[model samples]
Target: MDVFHVTDKDGNKITNEKVIDYIQQSLGTNACLLPSLRRTVGVKAASKHTAIELTGTDRPGLLSEVFAVLTDLKCNVVGAEVWTHNMRVASVVYVTDDSTGAPVDNPERLSMIKVQLCNVLKGDNDKRVAKTVVSTGVTHTERRLHQMMFADRDYERVHNGLLESRDDKFRPLVTLQNCVEKGYSVINIKSKDRSKLLFDTVCTLTDMQYVVFHGTVDSDGPDAFQEYYIRHMDGCPVNSEAERQRIIHCLEAAIERRVSEGLRLELCSGDRTGFLSDVTRIFRENGLSVTRAEVSTRADKAVGVFYVTDAAGNPVHAKTIEAVRGEIGQTILQVKESYSKSPSEETGGRFSFGNILKSTSERFLYNLGLTKSLP
Candidate 1:
């Protein structure tokens, strides 16, 4: 509960007092912590589907709750992506009509979905509450990771539950073809649709700074087949064989990771300044990438969920995940254990935030940390 952090004028977390003192004496002041705010949900029409955007203070289970509301509305998520900076988060999800298998077009249904999301985001008792995710003797960090795996009720169904139910001799199938006449590249990916399949694939392309002009996602039961028409930032098709293979490799790897039974990381701790940054840094430093993440706060405990993968953009096996778990857990333990050990430090391990980070590295790191201490 005693989370203190120092911030330079640019909002960077200062590890030593010398930096903080200099900032204060020469540059004035900056932010030290992130305060929670009431949730805000925005919706729009995208292509032929519904695009829903959410923004608010960061909290554990937030992503799960958002998808839960969509499920209740009988909406099928075709694409979704989320980013958390500091404690502020913004996410966009593309959904379609569950029964019709087409983009949502009814205004009434969209409005209802929006209203229900507001209720859940605001923690309104009148609507419904997600069952509290708890465990016997489970630490806060594990709790956050568990939310990504178990998440809210219906999470498995929501994510299409392809991880556990796959062909006995199944393998990811990926191919890329150029449609020069259309001036775009057609990438066909076939894989068991795990949680965030669309998000992960699309996020990878977007992360590469490519533009997706058109795409289609379809799933028969747990297996999903998706095709995307993409081009480089300059609108050039990816014609090089090596480049196409690279894209396929990264996407195929991501899709396969979704089913890697143990690809979940949880963080349960008191919310603190620069929480997201510190946690995600572990992922980056370890060559891990977060495909999906959800965060929320309950009873002063930060509960977060993340689906992660290794350097090749595939989920790590058990051994690698263990190392990732240890590094992150120790980092958080250091924060909490330092509360009493570092009294002279005004802010134990706090950082600052401004605009949504534009760089890939900062984007990778800005989107994540949380522990007992301020940093």
Candidate 2:
């Protein structure tokens, strides 16, 4: 059992280190967890191109080709994991130094790196790879929320100094408050449209099910388009033992803490790893039982909106919920949230960039018939 700590893009600690081999194995490749460690290293931590771990479907001479490219980029190869699953080869390589002190956050640079890596690993083909970039901004007040809601993407770029900026007009129509209350967002990207390049990339990476809201192209200069991306359901299932453990720990703790007070928990998160098991354990530990519940995943995010009761259905106290929120976020929510929103309906349609990448990898394998052997 390997323990790992999860962090945000800006090097903020999100979850404590815990044994998560089950989660890594659930990823269909133990190497899938490599990026988690790299991310924690902090992008701002300056280093020459250092060795990095790489893992994915393997092709002929894929390793050699990738190494060749790494050599050209002056990156070091420190570690690797290569295996074949469902007729695809997956490899993990640890490279040092990302040329620009760290992997450049510039959109074009990131895209170029992805393309270069993919070309070497996958060759010249329309293999779909989605990349999501999420930058967290702390808003201790509601006024800040309003600003984020209304801020244009270009304004965001200018503020953030993004060289390859997205359209200024594009904005998430629904606010976080709206998402929680509505159980869905009104904005989203259309996977079928070619014009919504960035939005489509985000949707694919995040595994969002978006209904095309609107689109337009300018007769002169750059085109203008806006579409909202909404998450309908978490595309993958909690088939991994690791996710199951975390879920169980969180739910059980929540239930146990609540039962001591003679109440139930009203869960409003999506499907997750050990949700039911954890909830049940907590109830059992505290001499309680869940009367009725509803839990599930929405678009790669975990949620469990359950009206917990005693053996007989009864309302849980508000205090019980308040008591358990911290624990829930600390454990089960780590994989679900992953720099995105908390693993609750309160923060939906928002997620970390790495989660989006993981989703894209899963989608790619599933679409290509590689994950069929997972179950």
Candidate with best lDDT? 1
In order, candidate lDDTs are: 0.50, 0.31
lDDT of 2 at 69: 64
Query: Measured by TM-score, how close is model 2 to the native structure?
Result: 0.23
Report, for all candidates in order, the number of backbone clashes. Answer: 24, 54
**Could you give candidate 2's per-residue lDDT for residues 1-375 as a string of tens digits?**
211223333334434333244334444553321111211111111132222223333233444465566555554333232322111233333344434334334445444445566555445652433222223222111122111111211111122243423222322221111134324332322111112233223322232222322222111112222223233345223334554343333222211111111232444444433343444444443333332222343455444432233333234444544444554543442211111111122333221222121333334435554334432
Tell me each candidate's TM-score: 0.31, 0.23
| TM-score of structure candidate 1 | 0.31
Lowest summed lDDT window (length 10), candidate 2:
33-42
lDDT, model 1, position 93: 62
